[model samples]
Target: MERPQQPIEHWLDLERDQLFLWVPVMLGLGVSAWLWLPDPQAWTSIMLALVAVALLALAADRGGRASRAVAIGCAGVAIGLGLIWAKAERVASPALTKPSAVQFEARVERIEMLAPRGIVRLRLVPIRMIDRPGRRSAAALPAQLRVNLPIADLPMGLSRGAVVQMGARLVPPPPPSVPGAYDFARVAWFDGIGATGRGFGPIELIAPGDASGGELRARLSMHVRAQVAGGPGAIAAALATGDQGAIPLDDAEAMRRAGLSHLLSVSGLHITAVVGIVMLVVLRLLSLSPWLALHWRLPLIAAGAGALAAIGYTILTGAEVPTVRSCVAALMVLLAVALGRAAMTLRLVATGAIIVLLCWPEALAGPSFQLSFAAVTAIIALHESPRVKAWFAARDEGWMPWLARQLASLLLTGIVVEAALSPIALYHFHKAGLYGSLANIVAIPLTTFLVMPAEALALLFDLVGLGTPFWWVVEQALRLVLAIAHAIAAAPGAVTALPAMPQGSFALIVLGGLWIALWRSAARLIGVVPLAIGAFWAVSTPPPDLLVTADGRHLALRTIDGEIALLRDRAGDYTRMMLAENGGFDGEPGLLSEHRFARCSRDLCIADRVIAGRQWRIVATRSAYLLPATDLIAACRGADIVVSERRLPLRCQPRWLRLDRPMLAQTGGVAITLATRQVVTVRQPDDRHPWRVPARAAQGSDNLCCSMQGLAKQRQL
Candidate 1:
């Protein structure tokens, strides 16, 4: 005790006390990589081989500490690979490969109202799949399918447990719209949904579902809707039953732009608020009763109550990955409090992440998992640092020191979270909330102190059939929250769009963030180098000049003025959003105007540009197969590039670059570089992974000819 602490002699002499915390993070990263491999069987064999070697190394114990460390690393890798293999096996099932009309009877497990789309999305569990009416088959179908039924088709109100027979066209979930975009098919696969489609004929309801959790959730949602109607009502229903389908699109966009979208989701913040309020109220009531207070350990009792509250809330919200994660963390913290130990530590957060990753390995590839853990880890690392603690201790004492300290903590926490999540937000969504901290300062307090507690009371009253009055109070609080969100989103520069960063750059940023957050010494500052490099690369990457849709039905080109001009106005929302977001353009897609650089007609649209003193003609047409012979000849006469919705004849454009249905299907969307005349498809051969279905080969070799000719011709010029 009398000896002074010795300074760390080497940069590598970092503390090993918290080294175990990194085990889960490393394993998760490895699992994520394994999931993206092109050959799952190969990886599985490799992992097994590594496990055997690790076991042998442990048995021999030749190199002492170094060998032990190597063995531990190998064991971690093997575990990660094994978890990924288990997940793949569990979710494997027969999937719909082509569109087919079939009569199927299914029980409606849940109904989500897509108000904007004027349809209801039903989550149905298959009862029977028939090739025809009254005919049964041994053919396997997906465990579940999300079917969209038009509102008018559902003349009878749809409810949970309602078995219905209907004729519908079903197809597998569509692939990603663009490279590195969100993969809905993969998400569906993990959710046990193999197909999606819309009902064509009338839906005949048979038997109502028995009283189940889903039915209860439906009842609660209907009650919430009946008690309160409009935007606030929709918000209330979401908060109560976790059904967010009814939320207006405009309101949702406003919340996202203002960075208050987390308030809408049932996450750690909402769960903690509900549990903390319930615990505080219960503890206060217990403390007033001297007999109980003297006989029982009050802190332990309160912690137990809070943990139970968190669990109840989790169940009410469907216990999704994010909700389950929050519940796990809350329970761990409450357990610590019950044991009279410090709770807010990196180890606890890591433990919660480990549990979540083990339960849902696929979640490692999602933004929510990454952002949530990054925020928590950064905050804990910052607050628990000696320098930060010393700084707080040195602050001058003044009136209301406790209040001042609390406010400072809140402000710093907001700042830390935003800083930690900014890169991830930019990488995934291509938009950063510039005023996130300012919005949080106003929104978080209101949401925590007034809104959630009022909601809890309203829910209790609703159970007793006296919820209307308290529901009005909750609506009022929600109105204020929405007003704040609107004001913030309306402010200038509230949300800034950034170009999509390269995958390598994003990887660097993530690695750098981990280094800075996980290390305990001053040498951790070295992480800033990779962070800077990633930032520079992200900003310097050039945008594509031309964009072609997967179906070859739409084309968008970056004009000389830097605006993205669509060859046609109509396109799917996903395709439009991907182009706009990646191109760093905001708002709606711009149509190619006849008065500008392009000429358009009923069936054809063409544009021209001068690149390096050579006139390059771009042509887009509807239904190449339907084009008249004369019109086709005229269109292909002098075109440098042609894009069409149907396959073109080889003789039609022998010397020109052509993109048509078959080529687009094989390559997905294509992006062109004007300077080098380089073409990049959204799906390259190297990007083929085992998670995606294999693509069929295109019919023609015209695309190959174009590539070779274009390069050779460009060099001659």
Candidate 2:
């Protein structure tokens, strides 16, 4: 006989204890509202909206039924919106309008060494800027600037808190590479970085400031590198000091593809391992004395030690978003243990998320925050299942059975977490690991149990100059981990790449996942509907047939042979890669001039593309030079769209849209669908976010050749 499903009300009643799990979700919705809301509203308007929602919630609470819960949910959403809105206002700063070359003196706030690239990056607070005439100007600049100094030019004794004078070229934070791509400018805005540039000329050390914590971190990283050599040493330094800048690019990419990159960062797994080790040591020491064990509360004392260890470890690891979140969760667990309650649960995870959001509301949109919390939540939810709990419970069995059970449990947890994170991974990185579970089964235990402990001992013994043995162990273990990562990454179908997913589809998938993980009753199964629909929608969405960069000098299109064709064979690596990824092609693109679908000259290119069963012609500029009016007009006579890097004369008009330099400047980038004549832009015209650069009025230049030369120089940079 088949069992009948219960009503929504029955399920809700059965899962009443699970309501708190939705708090973080509600708060995240509010954050999303602030981030994705099309219309820009004033701070006053946001405050009023928050007040209205809070009052409405109060009124709803007075009513009967489940109105109170609804009211609370609404209030959470309002708080999220208000929190992010306030954060943006607090961090707002002016961005650079154009590229500038000038002399400047600034205090170094931080330093990061990129060993692979042989660059030393400095985060500086400007003291003043000097013009070409050697006069200090009052022109406003960003509060913080990130400058990259070539290793050869890096001055000796340059460290954090040092003030140095140097000449460099500065430019505004770059916009998105294509429509619907990640916005680096937005991230820069939140980080308070107004400009990014490269250093050149002589670097004169003005004042080498006193030693600071940053210097200690740098010294520790350098010492670790010196003690151990090669990729293993780099991994050890990353694990020990949270400085991943020195990691080799090849090794990092392999780890990323193998899904073991999380080990490179300080997060829940690392923190938990450290805390557990500390607690075990403390407990063992305290139990040595029977009198003290009976008189004192040993577990509570050990938990306090673990809590302090978690905090200290977080600080040592730079206190990044993921580390801080893990620290909060660990503290909550310790508190629960002190109060004699359940140490780990969904409620605790939700609580930790809420705390993190309250502190860094903008983190809601970042991959680190989302991925870390989502992975933990999914794992906790899985373990909370009654069937899973019973299966892992103790039983009278052989050591082989126990080992098999542990292995199965690890595999199951990995698969569930991977499934929950796939949509998010695809949405952000355009790729997700296919064999992450298989790789992590070996990697996690190796890193957590063998490598970290050995590295910690090595660091401890280094104070007495007797750390060689421990360092050797650390090196050998890490070498094995790296070997496994490389092997897994090279395996067939180790990764699956997809095109950018629509925001709406991503939202549905996330919401469905939340519902399934948060609820305990049959109603949770209902989430499968939206999950399936979102996946189908994501895969079936048609990619743009024609795409143009914001600068308008570069363009890519899908040809009749279903291959991606680029305007220039020597286009920037990042630009070409993004264009192919956005167009749903995982491989290289051919030059449009070489393809049968397009003909190109030094200044002009006309590409023929068929999208959605309709043929369309796209005419675009291939260089920064302006073509003769007659030639341009005659060539683009009946073109569907004209994308020119130089401003097109009014006499030359396309049938549909004309995206010139000015238009592209306002739009950021463009993606077009030929069949429906639909167009998508990187940014909306009405977006009044503080980070957005206002469109500049077009000005006439007396010498077009000079302007073109400057553009060429900028492109080279």
Candidate 3:
């Protein structure tokens, strides 16, 4: 008999970490060289040195298993580093980009409509630069543009696979990030784009465009949507199709509030759901066939079909990064089963992860990639337990087996997935959904049964004369589904914005999740680490310095001499998320109230107006003060210090009001221009309201000064 194998371990088992160390370090070093090295010689030297060290380490570790480990790490690191270096160098090639416009021709690869901003991905067309008179010879630039098309009046005919041409400005995507900053432009580049543009380009229609990927894929996608049109259906379509575009923000909010957003997004839950669905259906169908039941291949066919169907569904739904990563992982597990090989467990995960990284290394930077992979790894180990699997599979009189699985799996799997992912979510999104489980329960069935199917059918029917009933029914169902989602979302306590959790919490959660996934164990107590840390972090986060309302009203506290100046009735989504994370009151609020600027409230800092003197100047205070102003002809002038507090009834020609830095810049004047143009020789030394007095200069100049000061105070708050 063969020697007993080590039971399959979790992906995060301690040994896996040892494996991970080499890859990340190697890749990180290569990335470092590419990012930090100034010259080609430095790049070559660093890479070679790192390679030599890694090789030496591998050679030293050569002693059966230990040697294998070293070699694997070294090889993995080498590959990752090599890839990063290639991409960096390709982008850096001096001849690759033209600084001046040259006439070119390229194909339109994609069309992304983000309401106000539409992203049209195109292969390069030639660019031509217009030489300016009296200008010296300069670098020639490419004549391409990533069109920033404003579609207040959106055009209808734009479709996938359509080619067109136009004139625009073009620039390369930005470089990789510095140690601790975002480089979004560089990200866009890796997504296979060069230039963006706006409005319609001069077009010559190449051909009538059909839905993406031909009939079966498109039809299935359409069917999935049609089936899930209403109730849970809309959610199903979202998860199944990556078509969250049609989901109303409010409905989405409700799902989020209820903590069921993942159910509607085809996450690990969806992948696992499909896998179970395929496994059960395949086994049952085979059992029914007298001849097929006798053959082991019957179940195998079922498994294959089910897996294919799930993958098909994923493809129909646009196969977003999370879904794609999940698919890769699922496939890895399935392949092992089909080959009748002992499950590789963490090693399998490592293999799958390496495959994905090699294909899209840039995905490492995305939250979906992190969360999806992490969640899958956790659930894989959880499901591997005989006890856990038996419990889920055993008879339950409460509901249908499938339905029960749906519910249990949603909860159990969600718990596992969320445990590992909560930290990242909290750190990045800055809040945890308290009711996500409940949300998923309501959403799962709706998506699987109604929305995904309806949408799929509707799209199919659209192409054929026989699809009317399906289309109509799907549309009705979609309306109903969306309505319910909206209703649930609007309920009280539906969504509560929390403060930002720490990055440390998220990192720890990943670490703990990894641990739980890697080690084979009967009890799953260790899985609670992520949940515990996330909760503690969420609850303890501090209040915000500024809040911006959706309507553009901004609420923030500004400090002058440790006193807070409150800009009331203006708080927005961005500000709310920011405040909860940074959690500090830079200035002491004199007053706080609901919906107004008054002193002393329960919020982090009050939104009360304050005007206090600082060390450098007599900073005056004014709120809702009325002043006079005069207007002159074009040549005629105005006041030196013009302070427009709220608004003056009389137009001031030279309303020189001294404005404070409470309304303009969010930071102080430390970084403003030193050019001083306007000053007032005040006639009244002790006017109760010096701010009310209109001096003889321009209001615009005072506004600039006030903006600078306001900016300073704003950062503190």
* Candidate number with greatest lDDT: 2
lDDT for each residue of candidate 1 in 1-717, tens digit (9 for 90 to 100)? 532222332332354655667778667766866865556566767787778878887986744444455577677777877787678678876667656677788988777777767888888888897676466553555788888888888747557778888877777766665554566777787778877888867778777656477667777877777777877777878877777878888788888888888888888788889779989988999999999999998878888899998998888877788888889899999988877788888888888887887888888878888888898898899988888787566466776986787778778878888878888888888887888887888788888888778877888886778877788888888888788788888898888776566777887788787778888877678889998898788877776667777678877777777767777667677678788776666666688753377888767878887765666788888434377766776787768778888877656662446776655666666777666676666654433343355232232334534544553453344
Better of 2 and 3 by lDDT: 2
Model 2 CA lDDT for position 430: 79
lDDT of 2: 0.82
TM-score of 3: 0.60
Each prediction's TM-score against the native? Answer: 0.89, 0.91, 0.60
Best by TM-score: 2
TM-score of 2: 0.91
Better of 1 and 3 by TM-score: 1
Give the Cα-based TM-score of candidate 1 against the true structure: 0.89
Q: Lowest lDDT 10-mer window, candidate 1?
A: 3-12
Whole-model lDDT for model 1 versus the true structure? 0.75
Off by over 4 Å in 2: 1-11, 40-65, 134-138, 559-563, 693-717
What's the lDDT for all of these models?
0.75, 0.82, 0.47
